[model samples]
Target chain A: MKFSINQKDLYNALNIVRRAVAKNQTLPILTGIFLKLKNNKLTLKSTDLELGIKYDLTVKAESDGAIVLPATQFLNIIRELPNEDVYLELNQDKWQLQIKCINSLFKINGYDPDEFPNLPQVEESAKFELPANKFKEMIKKVRISTSKDETQPALTGALFEVESEKVKMVSTNTYRLSFIEAPLKTSVNEKIAVIIPGTTLQELNNLLEDEGSVEVEVDSNYARFTFAGIEVISRLIEGKFPNYELVIPDESNSNFSADLSQLHGAVKRASLIAKLDANIITLEAANGLMEINSAEGSSGYAHEEVKIDLEGPDQKINIDAGYFIDVLKVLDSEEINIEMIGPLNPLVVNSQKDGDKFIYLIMPVRSQS
Target chain B: MKFSINQKDLYNALNIVRRAVAKNQTLPILTGIFLKLKNNKLTLKSTDLELGIKYDLTVKAESDGAIVLPATQFLNIIRELPNEDVYLELNQDKWQLQIKCINSLFKINGYDPDEFPNLPQVEESAKFELPANKFKEMIKKVRISTSKDETQPALTGALFEVESEKVKMVSTNTYRLSFIEAPLKTSVNEKIAVIIPGTTLQELNNLLEDEGSVEVEVDSNYARFTFAGIEVISRLIEGKFPNYELVIPDESNSNFSADLSQLHGAVKRASLIAKLDANIITLEAANGLMEINSAEGSSGYAHEEVKIDLEGPDQKINIDAGYFIDVLKVLDSEEINIEMIGPLNPLVVNSQKDGDKFIYLIMPVRSQS
Candidate 1:
């Protein structure tokens, strides 16, 4: 391949595709980025067999060809080059790619483009579009609750369900759960549900821009997301997701509201001491005053109080401080609304903004006392 | 002890003294900061046996007492508190400290003050003062050459020497050397030289500010630096420094100058490929231009060119690209001056600013070809 492109454009394209480059050496070619130029369009793609990313940019083409270069080395060299015209050429006989920009020139050994595996495909007939900003917001909240435990493959991903007029995402690790729903208009005639791997959700969240809309497609074995001139294909988890609806509390016996920033700061400070033990903190609410206390450990004790507007009887519960902090970080409301049925039940944090609803649940830890 | 201190002030003081807290658990108390309240002064000190740091701030005291608290835990807690008056009370019976601020309360376990080790002192008779900014600059340049090899204790630190009107610091790891000298008037009649440990140089660099002057004292076993209401005491390395003067080239067969930033950028790009091999790059200077080339390894080849003003015959040498990049990063000059005698001799990089002279020498690596 022979082409001259702007340095910044090439660097940005590399950044998008390099996210899917294989981190392990199980397949050597998978650790490289496939580069192809034809009809003035330069396409770059990378895949680790489970996830793949592809980006394209227009360039001044001298010849149409292809090569697979090491993603890290090529990206580093391009990043350091001055913002000017960058010339690239491939030597098919030796499988080497030559890069030249101003006074710097480099020849990097690469693998044959033919050796690169094709990115997995999803059924385009099932594709639908949603607002990019809303999709990204849902991914951020749901991915946090995805399990790191690999034994249960379904739990390591988020369940994405889309209807003709509504979209919802849910994830749980048995200890905590996140459920988010947004009203989105689409032309799809049937309901679709798939489990997207946690890694794919993270990368999608990073690549999605707030201004555009994202087109998504799903099949039995693969899912695809396209937005902002980038394409991402991820392998769907084959196992069935658990019944998450039964885990979310349907009603609450008591509810309260407090300043979001104040309660966030209080919980973070309490966790400093509680994290030394099991990261467990007890919350007690009564008389318009909410008390948060860390279990006394080898470090010491921490107690914090935040004023709340109560609507029912007093309540108390013990829960993981880290889980509480995670939801608070993602919440952008002025006031945090919390609901609890009793000490043995889950503490539910739910909010609504711009017609979208988000609910987070933290399972209570049985206190020693 | 009972006192109410501003949270910001307490957090800043903790940040300074905690630098000396022991990272290993040889002695539990050494990993804690000793707090003493007396005569309206709140003193905090931490020591790791080899190094110690102390700072003092005035507070509203109701009584006088002392205790030792874990550095990490206390620092973290104080950092998270609001910027308001924080009340602290000591429970002598339990050896615990109760801290209250607004609606937040904490009780941290601490050790008895009597068990904390006292900070080492330096004789005041042998002290001299130097500009804090100048000293920090000298340390930044010289510390980069300090060896990480613990087998040679003296080479792992910088040799600091001060005369009546001149101060110098030198450090080398056999591959490269850094020499910095500045002229400043002092009251000392006798010359002093000591090897300051690498960790001390790092902490001193971090603590020193630009405005004030630093009072320095050197004894046989320890060196003390006091500035900005902070005191740092460090143990001196008990070994003789190598004769670095013998390694620096006294004369050169060819001298050249190049735009500092342009050359820096070129070398950094060329090293991208050189580092894949042995991090060795060859420099060829002639015809008013310099050519840099990386040896062809399993990765590939890299070549870069930089314009220069040259005098005398042409010169070429192979040296570690990393060592060359280090000096280039530290030099704040428009043009970088280089002196070379032959391929077998070291390459000298020296610059003079504000009557202060800085010199760096990079030894050549024998080329296999």
Candidate 2:
């Protein structure tokens, strides 16, 4: 194959596909990206068995052929090349690639394209288009709470609940739960729930542009997203996502409101000390003031207080500072409302303006004292 | 003990001494910083047996006392505290520290100050001062070549040679050597040579300011540097340094000059491909052009040529791309002169201008082919 393309275009396309290429895979062929030049277009495909990505870009084709080259090495070479037209040609044996640009020329070894595994065929049963920025925001707000432990495979994925006009994304690791909702344009008559791996959602979010819209297609077993001449396909996690709505507290005996930034700052300050003691920080609310504290002997102690408008009884609770910080960072609200039921019960936090649609619940830890 | 100090001042002092505290040491006391309050000054000291640093800052002192607090925890607490005056007082048992600022209070456990190791005393033998920026520049240029292997302890330190009128610093890892020199203000009757650990030199450089000057004191077995209200003392490595001067080629049959930036760009681009093959890149100079090439099967090859003014025989040499990049990055010269005696001999690189006295010698790798 012989083709010439702009360095920037090729670099950008390769970057999108490079994310799916396994860094160290048992199968050597899985580490390469399949490059095909045909009909004045170059298509790059990479996969790690579970997920796959394909990027296509237009180029000036002199001939038509296919080759598999080391994904990382090829990307690195193109990334470093100056912004100019890059000429690529396949040798007679189809085992060598020659790339020339400006005053530079390179000869790289290529593997047999036939050795690459075939990409999974994506079948669309339901397709919907949503604003890319909105979808990305929903994923970011909930993905962090997904379980990292592989044993409970179900908790490693984000549960996507789709209705006729709205979609909700929820994720939890049994310690903290995050739920975010966005309006969707769909004609589905029945409720659709699917457990999508957090990693796949994260990659899909990264690939979407802020200004454009994304088209998502979902089936019983797989989901596919297409945008900007690139397609991503991921297998759906096969398990039941827990009923998160049941766990969210319906009402609380104590409720308080505080400036989000002020509370976030106090939590961050207290975390410096709490991080030494298993990331536990105690929040005490009494007399219209909330105090955050973490103490570890010989290490140090950190304490900060924030005045709040409250309609609740006095209470103190110990919770994971990291979990609280995660929810606080993602909530796009100036004021936040926190509901405390009991010292050892799950605490609920939600944006005052967002109301109950995007609720976050975090379980408290037993006080060490 | 009782005292009040600004949070910013305490944080700055803690940061400077934190560099001297070892992360993981068998002795627990070595992991903490000894804080002494006396005569309205707070002294923070940390030592790792080989190196010690002390920082003194003025603070409000109600009583004179000393305690050892965990270095990392104290630093973290001070870093996150609000910008305000903080009050610290010893508890009734004198083993706990109570800190208060505004409406927040924290109590942290502390170790007895007597358990902390004593810092080494600085001796009066050789003393001199140099521009902090110039000294930092010298260390930056040479320190990269210091050996990381512990088998040869002397090579892990930068060799400091002080003569009657000249001061020279050299570091080598057998494959590469960097040497820098500067004029001395203090004349010495006898030559003073010592190997100061590269890590200690790095810490001292970090503590130094670019526009100021630093006083350096060297004794028979140790070296001390004082600047920015901080004093650092490091034990000298006791061993003979390799004779690096003899390895640098005195004259060359082939010489080439090129723009430092252009050459660096070409090298870095080619290195992206070369790094896949153990960082080996070949440089071929013939007729007025220099070409760099690196290729690994299945990965790829990168080739780039730079125009140069050469007035010597044609030559080809293979070298580690990373080592070559290190030499160029540290030189800071606009124009670089590369001199080669032969394809297999060590290549010498130096500045084309006269103001900077720096030389880098890189040994060529024998190409497998």
Candidate 3:
């Protein structure tokens, strides 16, 4: 490959594709980034078998060819180079790529481009488009509830369901769950559902921008997301996702709303001692106040009180403090509505703003007493 | 102890003494911060036996008492609390500290203050004061050459010599050396010298600010540094320091000066490939050009050329790229003067500014050829 590209443009392009580069993979080529030059366009691709990313940029190309270079080393070199024109030439026989930028020159050993695996394809089973910002917001909330345990494959991903008018994403790790929905910008003729791995959702959430919309194509085996001239293909999990709707509470015996920032601060302070034990803290909501107390052990005890506007019976629940903190961090509203059926049911934290359909559920830990 | 302290002020005071708190120390009390409430001032002290830090702040004291609490846990708790009045009361029987801030309350377990070690004292010693920014700058440059190998105790510290007219700090790891000198504002009748430990230099560097001055006291056993509201006491390294004056080159056959930023950028880019091997790079300087090339290996090769102003014969030498990069990062001048006698002699990188007396020496690596 022969190309002269701006250091910043190349660095930006490399950054997008390098996210999919395999780390500690057995196949040597999987650790390399595939680069191809044609006329005036350069294409970069990387794949770790489960996920892949591809990006293209226009460059000053003297010849059209292909080469695969070590992803990390090349990225490091380009990142350190000055923001000027960078010239690259490939030696097909020895597989050495010579890179020159201003007064700095480097010759890096590369591999044959043919050895790198091609990106997996997604059949056109269903296609829909959603606002990039809203999709990213939905993913951020759903990610906190995805299970890290590998034994239950379905729980490791979020259930993405698309109807003709709306889109919903739900994830549950048995103890906590997240459900977020948004209006679909582009309508689909048929209903579709897919389970995208948590890691893929994280990467997509990081890459999506607020200004543009992303086109999503899903099939039985793969899902492709296209946004901002970048393409991401992720393998879908093959298992039955649990029915999360049944777990959500239909009514509550106790309900209240409180300032989001105040409650967040209270829980974090209580967690200083709570985290020392099982990360569990009890929340007691009465007429006009909510008290949070951490279980005392060898460390010590922590108690916090937050004023709230309650409209139902008094309630007390013990749940993981970290789970409550995670949902609070993703919330943007000034106030949050909390509801509980009793001490036995889950504590539900619902966003109070209109048109914001984000609900978080944290299961109460069983008390021996 | 019973006191009401501002959360911000308490957090700030905790930060200073926490630096001296021992990590994984044998004595449990050494890992705790000693707190004392006497009159209206609260004293906080922490020591790891080798180094100690003390800070004092005023608070509303209802009673007078003292105790020791785990440094990290207390710092973390105070950091998370809101900027409000924090009430602290001690349970003298069980040695438990009850902390209340706004609506948050915490009970922390503490140890008896009698078990904590006292801060070391410097006897009748030599004392001097210098601009905090200037002292911090000298420490930053000298600390890079301090040896990481603990076998040679003296080499793991910087020889601080205070003369009637000038103050100099020198450190050498045998392979490279850094010597920094500054004009003494206050003349002394007697000369004093001591070796300050590397960890002490690091902490002092972090604590010193640009606006004020620091009072330094040095004796046979300890060195005390007092600045702002913080005081640091460090044990002096016990051994003879190497004579670094012999390592500096007296004269050079080739002397040249180059743009500091240009050389810095070139060397950093070249080191990207040189570090893949043994971090060795060859510098060829003659006429008005200086060329830098990495020692080629299986990874690849790198070459960089920078413009310079030369006044003597051509010179070529091989040296560690990391050592060269270290001095470049510390230099604040726009131009750097480089001098070399021959291939076998050390390469000298001295500051060009007339008022600044900083010299760095990097010994040449004899080529196998």
Best-matching candidate per lDDT? 1
How does candidate 2 fare on TM-score?
0.94
Give lDDT tens digits, candidate 1, residues B1-369. 999999999999999999999999989999999999998899999999899999999999999999999989999999999999999999988889999999999999999999999888776547999999999999999999999999999999999999999999999999999999999887778998899999899999889998899998889999989999999999999999999988887888899999999999999999999998889999999999999999988888899999999998999999999999999998888999999999999999988999999999999998833
TM-score order of candidates, top first: 1, 3, 2
Docking class of 3: medium
Cα DockQ of the candidate 2 complex? 0.61
List the candidate numbers ranked by lDDT, top first.
1, 3, 2
Worst 10-residue lDDT window, candidate 2 chain A: A350-359
DockQ of each: 0.86, 0.61, 0.79
TM-score of chain B of 2: 0.96
* Model 3 CA deviation exceeding 4 Å by range: A352-356, B185-187, B352-354
Q: Where is model 2 more than 4 Å wrong at Cα?
A: A92-94, A295-300, A352-356, A366-369, B92-94, B295-298, B352-355
Model 1: native contacts recovered, as a fraction: 0.87
Q: By the TM-score metric, which is better: model 1 or model 3?
A: 1
Which parts of model 1 are misplaced by more than 4 Å?
Answer: none
Per-model lDDT = 0.94, 0.84, 0.90
